[model samples]
Target: MSVVSPRQIAANLAELWSPRVIADVDDSYVKVARVEGTFGWHSHEHEDEMFLVLQGRLRIDMDSGAVELGEGELYVVPKGVRHNPSAAGECLVMLIERKSTLHTGDQVTDKTRSIADQLRPL
Candidate 1:
């Protein structure tokens, strides 16, 4: 068991998009990621995906258009909704997804999804 600081974790991982699992309880995993570029278009069949921008800009592309998220902004993709996420520049973000949810719902392309694999020490 351990206690960690987000700021310290952020400073330690200042140059990568790798996510560190900060906590896990019940059916939820809390993680932090550094992001840039565009993520693949995908959807969760049974879970909602939450993205919280800790810094920089992030956007979610919907069929209708795009929703831009700034620092402190958050966006949640509803179940079974198709969308693509992008960031013009490097951004810090926190994600909350179901413990059993796949990073990509139905999309199976190589770049279709990202799972939080590395849990950095915080």
Candidate 2:
């Protein structure tokens, strides 16, 4: 396999809240996406989701609390925990999630991207 840059992939993305798969690790997929504004409230009932900030800042809000992450930082949203991700400005993020994980979990909104859409080549 050839080495690839997830940051470059994220930088090239023209759409917001759309994630592109960069690689696969065992049962998980490595994804890159751009974020701005709100991504709605959603949860993966059977899997946890990890988010790493590649650029700018990100805020993850849950019923229990909220956390802000800057570049080079990461956070994991536990399974079944409803959370909403948002950013006041543009942010680049990498996500590691189960292969069966849905983009917006059980909540399907206009921003919800299908696995097929994420699997497309960058």
Which residue pairs clash within candidate 1?
Answer: none
For model 2, how does the per-residue alpha-carbon lDDT over 30-111 read when each residue is reduced to its tens digit? 9999899999999999999999999999999999999999999999999999999999999999999999999999999999
State residue 49's C-alpha deviation in candidate 1, in Å: 0.6
* Residue 66 Cα positional deviation in candidate 2, in Å, after optimal superposition: 0.2
Winning model by TM-score: 2
- CA lDDT for candidate 1: 0.75
The residue-by-residue lDDT of candidate 1 on 1-122, one tens digit each, is 67866434544665454566787868888877777888778788899989888888999997777789998899898888888988888888888888877755777765433553544354
- What stretches of model 2 exceed 4 Å from their correct place? none
